[model samples]
Target: MAISTIGFDADDTLWQNETFFRLTEQRFAELLSEHGEHQVISARLLEAERRNLAFYGYGVKGFTLSMIETAVEVTNGQVSASVIGEILSFGRQMLQNPVEALPHAEETLAALSGRYNIVLITKGDLFDQERKLAQSGLGAYFNAVEIVSDKSADTYARIFSRHGDGPERAVMVGNSLKSDVVPAIRAGSWGVYVPHELTWVLEHEDAPEGDPRFRRIESLAELPALIAQMT
Candidate 1:
């Protein structure tokens, strides 16, 4: 099948995102561990995030707030104000830093630009996404860039419908299984999972084995040739 449109995931899929989060998380873990075990703190933080999602939605700001909230709860309100400030500062830093594109990200997007209607379908803070895109320089290759609040089946459905590309003729390429592959397949689109070396645990999952519409690749560099074979 000739792909009418190709959608790409932003964060760790195209560039270095989780590394900053990971560094901040180590600090969070260290602070939280002062109150309890690492596992206990991690579980409580995850639960807090789940509960707050309805109110806070998604992104680093919400995540930073959740960390502070969890710290207070875990420490019985004895958590230091300095720790809270550090977390908030880290979130801001994540937004301000220059985005580093993944290996071959620019080259591959440039390669695929004219062959298909390229789109960036990513979820994050609006300002952060825009800043990253602007820094990436690959933004010029994409016909459209969408910064979604979430990437559910409904989100994919609306995006494909809006682009006038049906699922069978569309393919989603990203590193996240949660936000990229699973939802794309559920929306009737083909999914191409390109595993990044450092995947966020929240986004990691077992690959879909023996699924014709779902394909896995070692890296983004091989995508153009792979797409050629697929068609």
Candidate 2:
């Protein structure tokens, strides 16, 4: 239970990310409302996003492409240029939106920074992730920032090795049981799921309900005490 390093997932775990994505998506649906109902628009958009993930990875840019693709299909290729323009506008607005730190994100990081080698291991377009990290102002608390295209057990192994941290001496915290917790647990590190309300459906996975290496907390505020108990 001796954990020397703690890795955090940046998006939902550290700050308000999924909320923006959800907001943008709703606005996107509105733009294509004539083409389909809310449910259909959402489903089609998610389908586009899933397919695009492999090619574009994750980020505002990829999202913009998916929205364009969805709009074409939803509107049966008759979607006007104005609507396409509006969709691009939405993406730009999202990219420019100010990053808002989630509750206790900074305070908890400040508390952990001195005690552990803190790292931000998040998956997204590298530049966008870096931009958000820079905007967060909590970047100073982390020893390193790893903007990865994917999060897997092997990624964790490499990160731990690069930092001279062993799995037994490290832990991960994030909202996704799929991307953050499960992978870390499989890598022999402890993982904590700090659930965020607006998770993308694509990020959803059955929770690690009874995994011994996995833990769930109500908020980042509980992290320090949880780490203490684990130690």
Candidate 3:
């Protein structure tokens, strides 16, 4: 089957995302610097994030909770109430930040929208994702928008089915090889990785080697020509 539908990931793929979280983590480390060093705070936070992932899912809310947990543990309950408040403030700042599109994101979407049934399948807080989409001004390009809790093989398979594409007939394009590319390929779709310069540590994974359906490009500006060649 010829490729007819294309799914794009929202964060880091279409616009800037992880940078905000990265910046907020810096403030968190500073707030609790008395308790632990930067590396220690960061490691503790990552551990807390992993433990709370299933319960809190993803987004600023989960991150905020994880930061608080890390602060308390690192300080052994010596972390002040004022410091906790500051950590929460960092999360709020991130959520309130304006959506900024990556280089050529709008152009890439514009080029593809007319040619394929474009879909946005992103995982994060539903309300936060919706806010970002509305603010992005690129939402109009997509025929469908899905704000999912997780992006797994089943999720891609189901999404592709709805958009009327199978593994051989659909493409998933995003920044993370783990969340965006690998699962889509496992479900029989072409996977395109447009690597972001900075990504969250947890989202990193190795690309599938010797996978005929997988492609990697350095920029969104190159995507139109790539799609033209693929289809």
Q: Candidate 2: misplaced stretches above 4 Å? A: none
lDDT of 3 by residue, 35-150 (tens): 78898888999999999999999999999999999988998888888888888888888889999999999999998887899999999898899999999999999999988999
Tens digits of lDDT, candidate 1, 43-107: 88888888898788777887888888888998889888788887788778877878899898988
lDDT computed for candidate 2:
0.90
CA lDDT scores, all candidates in order: 0.84, 0.90, 0.91
Ranking by TM-score: 3, 2, 1
Kindly indicate the candidate among 2 and 3 with the higher TM-score.
Answer: 3
Question: Which has the greatest TM-score?
Answer: 3
- In model 1, how large is the Cα lDDT of residue 203? 73
- How many clashes in each structure? 0, 0, 2
The candidate that wins on lDDT is 3
lDDT preference between candidates 1 and 2, better one = 2
Candidate 1, which segments miss by more than 4 Å at Cα?
none
TM-score of each: 0.93, 0.97, 0.98
Model 3: worst 10 consecutive residues (lDDT sum): 160-169
User: Please, what are the lDDT tens digits per residue for candidate 2 over residues 1-231?
Assistant: 578999999998988888888888899888777778888998998999999999999989999999999999977889899999999999889888898999999999999988999999999888788888999899899998888999999998889768747777889999998899999889889999999988888888988888888899999999999999888
- Give the C-alpha lDDT of model 3: 0.91
